[model samples]
Target chain A: MGSMARAKVVALSMVDKHPEPQPLLAVKLSPAENPTAEAGADAAAPINSSALPAPEPEVVPTVSLTKVFRNLLAQITRERITTAALACVSIGALFLFWYIGTKYRVEFYIRFKNVPTPYEVFQQLTQVGLSNKYLVNIAISVRRILLGFFIAMAIGVPLGLAIGKYQRVRDLFMPVVEILRPIPAIAWVPMSIMLWPNNEASIVFITFIGAFFPILLNTIHGVHSLDGVLIRAAKCLGASEFRLFLNVILPGSLPHIFTGLAVGMGVAWVSLIAAEMISGQFGVGYFTWEAYSLVDYPAIVLGMITIGFLGLACSGIIRMVGSLLMPWLAFAPGGKR
Target chain B: MIMATAMAETQKGLIDVRDMGVTFGANDNKIIAVDNVSLNVQPGEFVSLIGPSGCGKSTLLSIVAGFVKPTSGDAKLDGNAITKPGSDRGVVFQQYSLFPWLSVRKNVEFGLKMAGLEQSKRNTTARALLDLAELLSFENHYPDQLSGGMKQRIGIVRALATSPQVLLMDEPFGALDTQTRVVMQEILTNIWQQFKISVLFITHDIEESIFLSDRIYVMTARPGRIKAEIKVPLPRPRRAEMTDTPEFMNLVQELKGLIREESLAAMAPEIKDRGLSGFGMKVGPKGVGDIF
Candidate 1:
């Protein structure tokens, strides 16, 4: 890739690699603009700076292969170095636990040794990374999640608004929503398979079911939580119902809608994986299940990590879209004093 | 056009409230919030409705603004029977209800947009109003970005944007600091004079009412009715210093006595157990009482 493209990829994927948020600990990773101070202020002090090994010297003079590799770290910004160091420590801590737990075969209820170690998982990722079948599995899962999430949004936003505004619409649909909301997406596998013509459709349907409730309920709640004064203000300004809905209700409910969309994106990934595993020709979920059957523990762990990456990407994209749509939220006036 | 004409025919009184009464809830549990209150605001006149807390001042304004219906009497504007909220009777709520999502200019332009003005016309109107209110500089800021006083100025201009025939304000400056309140009162009177628009303002502050109003209506306690109508004999182009004048102070003292009497009655021990004694308001079953 071109240098510009590589930088773009780095910027976009920086936060997308992590499965969980470290909102306080997360720094923006700009070029040495003093991020450590901010990261410290909000989160636990960046994995204790002393615990991080000193960054190797610059690569300007030394040309030995291993030394060159170590010195190459100098090219990265201080913020990135700190982040990388913290991430390395975090991942190392997790692996340390996994290695010790599995080596001793520690048992909670069952044998923890059954789970592959971090080394085993990385080896499996390396073996499968170049394979076309794994790529296709990832492709299938992503396609299902995107399609299902889109369908959920298309159906959820309008329906949510209708249910929110009118009491009668709410009364009519709420019972069904309440009844269906509690059922897990996996439990719907049988019915979804029966209803759809093929596994692809069934898997997408399950994903949609997982996402639909959060967005719908959130939209309804957004409408309910809207300040009555705004509506009154609009009406008193001579706004017709249509105008009121367009100018006030829609915008007023946006903060809530975005929240619902973000949560729905998370659930969509979760359900898509499970649904694909239960019944699918191909997907990361199916790949994991297939690996389990073959007793390929490393490949199964690799699949799990891939799912985590996918979930992070989905949620990250939603967060980006939310900030873009509502610039006001990102720009607070003065200090919050 | 037909509706405007019909409204003109019916609007013999510029703003007519005839023995209007409002009772919230029903039957035995019913509480009379406003009682047989009748008043008017002539064309180009600024009228203030002032009373002790919970004397139904806001409720009366709400009726005129068509957000609430009068149980017995009717509220009419320009001969048109006010039924529902309309642009013809623009309203400025005390809460500074500038849509937080909209910019200051857009907040002012909202009513104009709803009135179906063309883009250029809406822009012109909003800009002129903002310029008049000296909010042109902060026009791009959101409501949350502006100070409380700035937000209320935006609210006032927004109400005036549609060129409503009669403006109804419910304690438009009640939330501001005392200093900001005085400044806002000055800005409001100037705008009222510049536009020559009829106004029906509701406020609990006696000094604020007399400073901006052409006449002040003092209302009695619970089941609020008009107690006395004190016309401001003060000449046009009112200033803050006018409050120091003996005449203004005497009127302030006179109104204060009337408000205190009603306030004492509103605080009467018979219903005091409900935590009823609210300054300048009526006794509602709700947590606090502000209107009678």
Candidate 2:
């Protein structure tokens, strides 16, 4: 008998030997008429009616090298074109919006309807050299942002680690943080001026408040989310409490710390601009405000562009640091944008 | 063939546990994990700890390795009390406890670094242990890049790099496939024969216990006491086929009997009320496949 007939016999015997009635007949048997029509009806009859069924059909090998290569090439081309198209559309759209928006400006004091073109903004950026008052304004902003960022990191990272690692400390400080965190740094400008009596102190306080929460939250999350298994493994390997926290916990939490730093840096840049504009004698925000007062739309656009570019640079540096510190974690699938 | 001499070798204790106990949580909410239990493990011996789930077999092993401090009594290694985890007692955890960031070589060197060995000594010991574990070729590979068996092998090498007197493995092969578990069992046996460091292997597999250990220390449920200390007389470098033998079969039957009794006894009203029907299924057909 053929394999099909032999399989049928085996199936029949399996049912007989077990002597257990299966309530659910999970298997489906197609009518033999289709196969019988394909072959001769008489020829298929004995095979179907036989005590045993056939063994499974052997897999046939068929190779087409050209077809395989064609598919691979098609996949590569499709991916490449899609990525390139996406890049072009995104950059094109951004430039288009910026160009259209800057083409017109309403200067109420000057009563001018149409401003100079977007190219004038680019020309103004080039003319604003090292000695230009605008360049000094840029310098002042960069210095304050950097200083405030560093100060925030100095305070935030350690406090974050304590809050993340210990419950009592987290409880004690969490309420205070919750109360302070909701009060916007812009709103604190009046309070800062009264407390410190200087524009510099106010700007720094605003930047510190703006940058603090993100760094703190990220650091806490990084510490809290450390692998339980890794900690257990470290404990098993005789790692002392100090070594465990420093070597394992610190390194493990670094990725989150970097995330916090990136977010904190962004917040500091934005808040410092607002603070500088509202109170400071110099800096990018003050420069932008001063340009608005003078109705120099090109310089106003320049200040905004410089802020955008500087924020991008700061975040890029943070990302580079994160990748360097966590080379193992860097290759995560889809790469977080 | 089974031999009585193997059983004779395991009688002289290499590891002595005297009335050990452990209590977790604070004051009024305290729960006893392991209550006063004593066990003895001989040098050049493979002893298995088999018990119902939550019976404190793992707790008992952790105490032996000094990973867990006992509330009462002591776990002694070669007559000295084990107060803290040391390089002398190497432990293999259930999960892949390898440092994911480090390559295989660096992971193996971790214990040596902790021991304050110089670079030269650390490299030599790490290399030798890796070679013994048959993972020398994959030395530069990270733990994530390796297969389950390879990762566990690295874990073994890392533990052995310290030249630990006692290999306190807590279900090292528990996460592997049956085929891989068999392969790892052979690898472990070969390593045991070469080093003969007294092994306190904690497992719930009756067949595995029979296949690997020189003696089986069956533990009771809750207040986990030593139920029986049956000597397995299987010859050195035990083959996978030894599990098919009458001696191995009989021992497996005895262990299964003890485990079932203890498992039934452990089925308290609280557990029944909690509806944890699948508890301690490692020693039976219900969840026997889980315990490597």
Candidate 3:
């Protein structure tokens, strides 16, 4: 019975993907003819019913294509289908607008004459994606970003903790931080180049500068926002100063620390791309700038798309890690006290 | 038997406060939280501080817990000054101050771990305390997953994990619903009876004070001073039914009257500013409903 259900599922999935009118009939009728087949298929059906196509039909029957499509639609949740449909529509609308604007060469206040159409960019993406050079550039940019972000976390989090926990340390370091915080990362490029040994060091330093302040400021805020009663509770429970920090202060500040990390990652990408465009030998940012210089407009758009996806992937990774580290947050909304 | 004798010789859980006062800020900004408050708790006694809001009941408790330094006098435990918080005294806050990142068992074991207890011993102590609270099944759950009553119960169990001499609780059951609060009071009394540890509890609930404390100290409004000290003559191993007796009702009435007077006094300045000097008299005959 299990193997029979499995074979039926394979046939149904093939009908879904290929949409053969004959196979659709077979799927729609097999469930009706043998009542137990429907129950078995429902139980054995995989979450993603769009896998590889099966050649042979398990149970042939006679039914219309529309009826089979309706049956398949009924099996999934209505809300999920609606949400997915809405997302696709919105994305499609954006592409349609971009395609028309670029194809017609709209010359509004911001000219679209030089911009590539969706097709042109897709064509460029397929061509560029095949090359080892493009992958190397992406890898280099990712490596630089990870190195700078990790360094910022290592130094900024501890310094922020110290500055937040101790009044004397705050007083000593706050003046310097306040003075340097407002200066943009781009402005530091010249000074960073002079300070560091090479162009790579300078670019990394600029990325580090971008990521550091947000992490530091948020950490300080996290520490400041800790409940005083919690500290007192820990102290009364025999926690020494160091133990109190480990048990109460550090764990208490983690949610805010993650907030800082996410914000810092976004800023790190912006800073890295800016630094790369200005001084990098090889990276996605440099590729975009180089394409612009060589008048390869489609590749420039492809570079931007790559950066957007990479940034999204990095932020998503951070979010996933944060939620994993703080499982208590998942249960927070259920009970407040 | 030898260990029992040694424990008796250590002078377990005696809290002494002598004319202690705490003042916050300096000069014109200064606010006196507690003033000239003198109180003491005998070993194994259950004492409560009851007062109007803004009164120094919690401030006084904080002094004994060594979280605040008194501006005038001193607070002591076992004849030595309590200059700082120590393992000998455990505190439970109204906020249910369990670390959200930790599981229930880990929170209960926190103090033991801090005192450098071995992992196996910590687990044993935590499991025992959790079992005592009837929360052994929820040992793996985080604090945020629990209800108000459960959290406070965990808070109490966690505080008692280290076997502290004195337990300081600041309105631990105040956030719970009335039904849960009653159940919590019974649980606390049971725990107190079994441990025979001294307790210094702070609350604004008159009935709760009457029900829980062997002795109750009532304080006046802000710049708080001890207005009255009353003792409960109820027998030990107290049951929930004891709250219905004539004696409990009488004590509740007396404490209510005392607190009502202080509450009115606390509202005096606001009443005067509103040009309602005789408001209390006007509301007195109407049974409080008419004014609202």
Q: Number of clashes in every candidate structure?
A: 26, 16, 0
On DockQ, the leading prediction is: 3
Q: What would the TM-score be for candidate 1 when compared with the true structure?
A: 0.80
Model 1 C-alpha lDDT per residue in residues B163-236, reported as the tens digit of each score: 78888999988898999999998998899888877899999898889988888999998879899998899988
In order of appearance, the predictions have TM-scores of: 0.80, 0.76, 0.83
User: Where does candidate 1 stray beyond 4 Å?
Assistant: A1-92, A99-112, A331-337, B1-13, B270-292
RMSD of each: 13.2, 19.2, 9.9
Best by lDDT: 3
Interface residue Cα RMSD of candidate 1 after superposition = 1.8
**lDDT tens digits, residue span A147-239, model 1:** 999999999998999899999999999999999999988899999999999888999999999999999999999999998989999999999
Could you give candidate 1's fraction of true interface contacts? 0.75
lDDT of each: 0.82, 0.78, 0.87
Query: How good is the docking of model 3, by CAPRI class?
Result: medium
Q: On lDDT, who's better, 2 or 3?
A: 3
Q: Which candidate would rank higher by TM-score, 1 or 3?
A: 3
Q: How much is A117 displaced in model 3, in angstroms?
A: 2.3
